[model samples]
Target: MLRFAPSPTGDMHIGNLRVAIFNYIVAKQKNERFLLRIEDTDIERNIEGKDKEIMEILKKFNIKWDELLYQSQNINFHQNFAYKLLQEKKAFACFCTPQELEIEREKAKKEKRAYRYSGKCEEITIEEASKRAEPFVIRIKKPKSSIKFEDILKGKMSFDPNEVDSFVILRADGRPTYNFACAIDDMLHDITYVIRGEDHLSNTPKQIHIRKALGYTKDIIYCHLPIILNIHGKKMSKREKASSVKWLLEEGFLPEAIANYLILLGNKTPKEIFTLNEAIEWFDLKNLSNSSPKFDIDKLRYINREHLKLLQEEKLAKLLGYEDSQIGELAKIYLEEASTLNELKNKIDKIFNEKRDYKDFEKEANILKENILEVIKNSENFDEFKKELMKKSSLKGKQFFKPLRIMLTNQEHGPELSKIFPILKNKIEEVAKWW
Candidate 1:
């Protein structure tokens, strides 16, 4: 089984969604069960409805999971496992006070050394600790040897025994820490694969230690995807509005387009554009780039336009709040200048709704409007229509075309009239009436 575990802290970033896409697609390709685990154990930081919102976003992207779970549901199990480790002598109670630990940390800083637990509390017998009134935390024993594992994308990796101290499993507040809960849940849920961001690479050995301490000898495959950089050549930050998936969706980006762009990043694909289903046929983990990939908004906009073009003319028009296929075809002409559905809709709306100001050319605009209304009915095309109207007005150059362009498109400049005129030939009367 595979899992896409997200914390309910705030709006999910595109980085989070990209990780989910990788896990979901790989699970389907392997014919394995997929799970959505909402890691909401950090109650202090979790937003109340964000988990439901996350599921909704996943559904919008067509990600289906075989099972769903919240990490808090197994709090009892996580607590019990900590006690189990203590009983097996795989862990010990930590009696260090906050001030004492801080002093040790300062000492390490002064000595220019890494701050690890002094393990002073290990000398206290468990029986002796059972009778103490002071509150204490549970900590797993440090490994005596290196913890090593192979990552599908990163290849062989190793962590020294000293790198992982006797980290706390259960806090003084009777709550399990992140690594303890994550390790316990993965073991209990039978998660065979872990595909996540490289930010969690340091936590892997700690989790592996917890599993090994519990006698879970089965190997869990791992793929730590490289970090994504913004266009400015820095790591993507979730706090930024542009990094958010919610903001991207609200800006009228297609879900398919977003997924296509994400999958195309840092990986080799059969083609530049494809649907989610098409990607499932060819996605392989081995093709992922080890180097970080930059998030190019321009490229995503280009991909969004391609996906918009793939939509049927009638359907595309419906998304733009119109029913006529002609309107849909008309919208396509604006696609040359518009990158998003909202931009396309605004461009189309300009034709029939936006009030154009003629400024210095008001007189010429009115004359052109009257002439076009009179001769447009008989003209078969824009060139034919222009020939008849220009003859009647006896106007030429900027004096003729400028006002005519504003009368037809409600804009001083836009797509060539030759391309827009064909789709909007029937709507010319309505367009002229509004202007």
Candidate 2:
């Protein structure tokens, strides 16, 4: 099974969604279960409605999960396991004050040595430790040997035992630390694959130690995706507004477009665009780029436009919140002329602009107006008028409709002449009087 565990600290950002999408694809490709786990261990930073909003967005993008787990609800389970490790002599408690640890760290740095816990309280008997403990954080005792693991993507990664930090498994307040909680949760949930961002790669060695101590030797596959960076080549963050998914949503990006663009970040692809299913078929961890991918708004917009163009009129209308009846007409106009939604909106603005007058017509209108007016004035019927107009003007359909479009709708370009004419047929006489 695959799982996407996101902390509900803030809105779901684009970088986070990239990881979710990658995990979702892997699950679908392998016909395995995809689960959603809420890593809300950090209660202070939790945002209300964030989990619901994340679920809603994932649903909108068609990403599904088999189970929903909350770390906060399993506090007892984690505590029990932490205590078990302590009993087995694989973990220990330290009552070191913040100042003392900082001083030790600084001394090590000054001496160009790795800063680590000096085992200050490692030898203290349980009774003596109980007496001295004002408030203590539990730390895992690192084994004095090298640890090795095979990363699914990076491969054969190893870390020396001494280099690994003696991390806190339980806080002074009794809450489980992130590393401890993640290891316990992964084991409890039977997660076979650990797919997450590369930022968590450093924490892997520590988790491996915990897994070993707990006797979980069935090596889990770990695939760390590359980080997403801003266009300036810096790691993306909320401070960099450009990286936020909420910002893109606010700027009118369709969910499909965002999902498609995100898949391009690290995955190898020769094609410029792909549908959700196509992306799943093409997704492979081996093809992921090692370097951080830059988020480009322009490229995202281009990809969105292509997807928008391919959408069925009804779906497009539903996504854009236009009425069903308005869909066909609007889509026809959009497909025929506009390269983008903005362009279509601009044309709509021209249609509704009350200030536009006959004098605002293009120069070509002034050149052809006299002949057009004379032909209209002399014609005996609508059919005769059409025939005469077609004969006098060498313009084909587009040129023929150009003047009529400006006359009836006061717009330079829009829906096809046939479609636009039928919709504006009643206004033809009123516009003919202009010439």
Candidate 3:
């Protein structure tokens, strides 16, 4: 089994979704279970509807999970394991206060030294430690020897024994820390593969140590995916525009488009557009880019247009949620000539509702009226009308529609005349009233 655990802290960002996609692809291709785990151990930062939104987005992308688990619900299990480690002397409680730890950290920073707990309470007898009755955090006892592990993607990595921090397994409040909680959840869930961001690379060794201490060390794979960078070459964040999935969805990007573009970010193969099945078949951890991939809005738009073009006419209409009968009719005609569905929708949106006035078209409309009215009267068919008007005047669709469109809909561009003409042919005579 594989799992994608996300913290419910804010809106789901594209970077986070990319990680989920990788895990989904791996599990789906292997015919293994993919679980969704809410890493809400940081209760202070949890958002109310963020988890629901995340699940909804996953549904939108067709990312299925076998189980949905919350880390907070497993608190007791994590605490039990921590206590067992404590009894085995593999973990010990430290009564160091926040102020003392901060001072020690600052001193280490000033001295340009790596800070490891100085074992202030390492020798404190358990009885005396219990008698203190002071709030204390349980810390894992680090082995004197170095820790080494093989990252499936990055190969072998080694961390010095002294450099590793004696991290807290359980906080002073008796809540399991993120590292401990995640490890316990993975073990209990029988997750055979752990796929997450590269930022968690350093934490892998510590989790390995914990598994060893718990005597549950078996075959497990860890694949740390690369990070996604913003256009300016910085890590993408919600603070930046177009970084969040919600923002992108609002900007007219279809869910399939977003998922397709995200998959290409870190892993691009010969195939340009990929369906969910194709993604599952082609996705591999070894193929993920080592360097962070840049997120370009322009490229995203291009990819979206491609996906939009492939959608069925009815699907596109359903996706856009267009209800107007005329708009749907216009969409069919516009799509025939449009390079993509987005372009088709763009053209239809122009005249779907009341016309929007523009300054340039307002001035140009007056000069083009006499010629446009005569052309509209003379042409027998829509196709012939366009050709005749194009010959007499160099102006194409926009220029031709500018005066007539403004006269009727008060907009410069709109649904193709070929489409609008059939629906609004009666309105043409009414438009003639303005002339």
Model 2 scores worst on lDDT over the 10 consecutive residues at 421-430
Model 3, CA-based lDDT:
0.77
TM-score of every prediction relative to native: 0.96, 0.81, 0.86
Model 2 agreement with the true structure over 1-435: per-residue lDDT tens digits: 889999988878787888888889988998989889999999899999888888887897889899998889889988988878777767787889999999999999999998889988676555665687388878888867877888777888888888676778989888999999998888888888888888998788888889889998877889887788888888887877667777676666777888989988766786768877888877788888877888888788788777777777777656554545354355446555554455555554455434345444365466456566676567656567667777776555655656656765566655555555443343335455544
Runs of candidate 3 exceeding 4 Å displacement: 323-347, 356-380, 386-401, 405-435
Global CA lDDT of candidate 1, please? 0.91
| C-alpha lDDT (0 to 100) for residue 363 of candidate 2 | 57
Which numbered prediction scores highest in TM-score against the true structure? Answer: 1
Model 3 Cα lDDT, one tens digit per residue, 1-435: 989999999988787888888888888878899999999989899999899999998998889889999889999999999989888888898999989989999999999987878888877656777888678889988867777877787888888766566789999888988888888888888888888888898888788778878998785788887778888899887898688998887677778878888888777565777777777777777877788899998787777767766667567676556754544555555544453445565665554444445456665566565566677676667777668766666666666566656665554444555756655554455554544
> What TM-score should be assigned to candidate 1?
0.96
Better candidate number, 1 or 2, judged by TM-score: 1
Q: Which ten residues in a row have the lowest lDDT in candidate 3?
A: 349-358
> TM-score for model 2?
0.81
Give all candidate RMSDs, comma-separated: 1.5, 5.2, 4.2
Residues 65-145, model 1: lDDT tens digits: 899999999999999999999988889999899999999999999999999999998767689889999999999999989
lDDT of each: 0.91, 0.76, 0.77
Work out how many backbone clashes candidate 3 has. Answer: 0
